[model samples]
Target: MATAFKQIEDEAIEMARSVAYSMPIEDIDMTDSARFVDNTHWAFFERLRKEAPVHYCANGRFGPFWSVTRYKDIMAVDTNHAVFSSEAHLGGITAKDQEDDFILPMFIAMDQPKHDVQRKAVSPIVAPANLAVLEVLIRERAQKIFDNLPINEPFDWVDRVSIELTTQMLATLFDFPWEDRRKLTYWSDVTTIDVSAPDAKMTRDEQRAILIECLTYFTGLWNARVNAAPAGDLISMMAHNPSMRDMQPMEYLGNLLLLIVGGNDTTRNSITGGLLFLNENPGEYQKLRDNPALIESMVPEIVRYQTPLAHMRRTALQDTILGGQHIKKGDRVVMWYVSGNRDETEIENADAFIIDRARPRQHLSFGFGIHRCVGNRLAEMQLKIVWEEILKRWPMIEVIEPPVRVKSAFVKGYERMMVRIPG
Candidate 1:
């Protein structure tokens, strides 16, 4: 019986690997890992870190692209913004040509002069000093969200909780009116990674129509806020800035949309991912519960483990050598944050979950260098506060079912993470 069971399991594993090989992404759906990862993605990344750290991925969509999977290599490429530029507008951050005339350029999707000028305006809002002002309110919001969590009953964390809190917080940050805040989150979803989702079939004209509608709707807010003084919100900062003062009405709205979407989707996904990771590693969950003081250290561990944004793409401006490999100019480069966070060299027991792992913040979820996530502080604060509140309310939250991942290669996220919290 044991031999037969073992044979059956081996065959099942082999079949899963075969299925993984047949698709472009394995387990992209949160519930399915086979959609994005098989033995191959891991083996390839591990081998590349050792043999060809700056190797080319011929299977990618945006032409053949180079991949930087190791911690050091990603740092090298990310920090050297001059060579590995983020100015690829045609196909946002992922190494895919899916963006069909998407015009909303994130601060992360542009190169300097433009990137630097724009990043400076709201950078202050997310700075460590300024973030403290928002911490109390964030904590309050978190407490409220967790207090309502359904205990001992299966619930979709991504939809019922994570997205709700995240989008609401984003709406708060933008000072958007409560009645229309859902619209802000809706447009944000369409703006960010809609090209790769089920919604991608919208006609080109329809896409343009949505873009125009988004701009037109937000332009009213922009114009309204232009006359008002700075009120400690993102909209005010963008509208009244000296640099942005004479900017085209739509240009400012585009950036605001970027901040809302970028800040909302990524962190929300991670919150769900974090819970799922804890669910999978129950021993680690116990470790966290045993030491409430370790939450700070665990935040980085969770970020590294979950990797909110799986990867970010950069374009090589000129032919150059990286990781002992030669690369041509304008070659697409992928910084696999998920793989890099798992690099054994930098992370001791990289595969294991260590709550108090020293220097856990070294993970690359926020990328690095000039184009690192502008809202890093804010993300950390929100995640920490939310988890703290979650533990406070229900010390026992468990994954009842595997997550249902977004069917997106880009913005890789958990769409439905069925979990049970103690009643």
Candidate 2:
């Protein structure tokens, strides 16, 4: 089996080289697969995972981007912050929308000291200890959303279940009015979508404007709470915290935006992705039904399989060599976590979905080192709730229609999924 897979991968390598070298450099982004819901993108990632693990793509949709597939290669890039830094000086963590001299210094794009300061401000609230308080609320909301999924009919799971549940959770956490929860998802989607397609509805400038307006309003809410002598909300937590030294208003806003989107979209997609996977692999779904106890172990497998965030880009701080590839100072390195999680070298029986694996949660989806997802526990808790409620309410689900993937590769998520929910 191993030898056969290797032969197949080698053939794919040659195919990729022929395609990459001959293709026009002008169009190299992942947009081509936006509407194609099948696993073509995953197939492309699988090919790279085997051949030229850290290969380069000089021209594509994102344009002249470096590709880092395979588990070890992604781990190498993810762990070495000093060598593969997130500083915008190199190019931020993305290959597109890069302007000449503009900087959007979110904490995710900065190195220590600066990253440390802003990260520290929000650390207390998201820590496992503090976040435990919200599990009840999160679980309750997830259950309500799952139940409303039309147990006997077909519906769009992405909008109704995924987006709706996640937005409500974000609103609850951010202290935003419940009616405005959808706006959080709206902003997150607009902000994360790549500004490349000629028909792209929202431009980066427009997104920035919306982001600024939203943050200004949030800041006002935080201020009102502060002036009222009771900082009860998440914004209030940040604004009134004396420990938040040297944190600028923009930094605060960036962090807020990050939390709103990060907390919402990734988890939402994971939910939809998990359900869609289970629907496609009914045998695996049946296996889970038989071993319902495996849900705990399955959480990690779900994360590994779905890999909510497709890729994260980093810039080289200085001239360095990665897995024999010459990475010069200021060169951007893109790490494809989706490919890494599926790398056969690291995972035995890498292609199959195994929920009962001994160590299933081992993937770079939540990232690594200091920048690892702070809300990982909350995300897990949410998934657990969904699965728990799923088995309790309805034991069988059918994929009436194939899932539709989001347009952007940044977040490889379901834009539409139709399933038959048997009550």
Candidate 3:
């Protein structure tokens, strides 16, 4: 049964590769959400990396934009904040432009001093001491989650494991109400949903209404925290810090959404991805079984293989030459971290998921430069703890079917994945 599923997936990939090669270079649009849903975006990105490392799409779904698809090229753009900007007013960190009336000015979207100060306000949450404390809590929770799994029966790994664990962690970080923790997961999903997709769950208006509810609820918590003595939670940190304390309502909402999504998506998706990859590559699974100590390297490899948060967008602050192409000021520049992670020039046999690579951490998943993921160590610790607990208990957790992927070019994640753990 597993072989049959693998064959079907392989054929679909071959068909995608064929179409990718046949299509004209000028017509390829990476922003199409359908490609991501079908998991065919791999071929599109592969073509872009080889032929047009810095290609421009004249009429993208969002707008005209340049695609930076190589590892070195992506690194160059990511590190050069002076010339390439992530300003929210300039459309923020996504290929899709922010709505004119709905601009959310988070730190990641700001440049220079403002971005630094605001980021510093919440940076202590992931300090080494904080992570040391989190590791103990994560392991205990992971054990409880694993102990409750249904034996010898199929269940949705995404719902049962991935979403639940990540959402719980998000709730802890915000010091949110424990019973309403799933709200964080829901808001994270809504924040990244491709509203234009045919299968979209809600319209833009509906999404806005829900997000406003989230802001209202968090605003109450913020107000409460502001009056109390400083605490360790993110809300308390932001409330106490001078740099973040004076933020406007929309700015507050924007940073809230950023922390929620940033904390949720990357870790959640990689947790699910790790299981699926291990199942797909049984040899690597066997290698893991032989040496459980490999978990240190396996975690980052899983992150790289998943490449959650597929791309980050920047606007050209001024005219610049990137990959020999002239980028005009104010033009949208998208660095495809997904493609860059798979660049063969930088990573040998990049397409293959080899668990024990000598340099497992040398990938673009966590990104680079000042705007890199702040909770990266926390993320790694959670993944490491989950796998450690899993190895001590289950010998194997079988992925019974292909994962239903999220319908967004930006967030590469699973919506559902059926799995069974043998009794």
Candidate 4:
């Protein structure tokens, strides 16, 4: 049965590759979420990187946009914040444009002095001293989680491990109510869900309503934090910070959602992806088991291999030449970090899931330049602690079936992955 599944999967990948190569370069729309759901966006990206590194999609789902597929090209766009903007009014960070009524003016979508100041407000949460403290707390939580998993029975790793751990960490960051922690996971999903997809849980209007509920809930927390003395939690930090204290309601909600999704999705998906990658590459799994110390490097490799948050969008502030292609002012540009991370011209054996790459940190998963992910160190610590605890407990956690992937070009992740642990 497993062999049959593997064969079907391989055949599907071949078909995807064939279509990707046969299609007209101008007609190749990488924003099709169906391709992402089946993990076939890889073939599309491969073709783009080789043939048209800075290809334009004239009729994308979210309208016309430019796709930056190569590593160097993506880096150029990411670093040139002056010419390529991330302003919310200009569509924000995702490939899809942010609706005017629901615009979330978070720091990531801002340019220049505003972005720097707002980001600085929450920077202390991942300070070296805070991370050291979090390390201990994370390890304790991981051990408790693993201790409760059922032995010799299949379970959804996405729910049992990935989402649970990351959600718990997010709760800690926000100092949220323990019983309502699962709400964080829900809000994060709503924040990134592609509403146009066939399987969308709700319409864009519905999603906005739910997110407003999230804002209301967080507003209560913000009000509480604002009244109290300053503390280490993210909400309290923002509440006390002079730069962030006077943010508008939508802006406050936007930043809250940013931190939630940032803290939730990237780490959650990477945890699940690490297990799937290990099972696919048994040799690397054994290498990890043989030298548990490799966890240090393995953590970053997992993040790169997963490449969570597949792309970040920017709008051209003015006419610019990227990779010899002319981009006009106000044009939407998307940097495919997922493609860039896998660019063979840049990283040696970019497709392989080797755990011990000499320079494991050389990947675009956390992005580049000033707008990079803020909670990166804390994310690394969480993954490291989870793996360390897993090594000590279970010799192997078998992936019984392929993961059910999320259908979104922007958020590359899994919905569920069934797994079993030998007793």
Top-scoring candidate (TM-score): 3
Candidate 4 or 3, higher TM-score: 3
For candidate 4, which ten residues in a row score worst on lDDT? 1-10
Each prediction's Cα lDDT score? 0.71, 0.73, 0.93, 0.92
List the lowest-lDDT window of 10 residues for candidate 3. Answer: 1-10
For 292-409, candidate 4 gives per-residue lDDT tens digits of: 9999999999999999988999999999899999999999999999999999999999989899999899999998899988988989999998899999988789888978999899
> After best superposition, candidate 2 residue 386: deviation in angstroms?
1.0
Predicted structure 3: clash tally: 0
Ten residues in a row with the worst lDDT in model 2?
A: 1-10
lDDT (C-alpha) at residue 279 in model 2: 61
- Cα lDDT for residue 342, model 3? 96
* lDDT by residue (tens digit), candidate 3, 75-166: 99999999988999889999998888999999989999899999999999999998888888888888889999999999999999999899
Q: List the residue pairs that clash in candidate 3.
A: none
> How many clashes would you count in candidate 1?
15
| Model 3 stretches with alpha carbons more than 4 Å out | none
The count of backbone overlaps in candidate 4 is 0
In model 1, the worst 10-residue window by lDDT is 25-34
Residue 158 displacement in candidate 3 (angstroms): 0.4
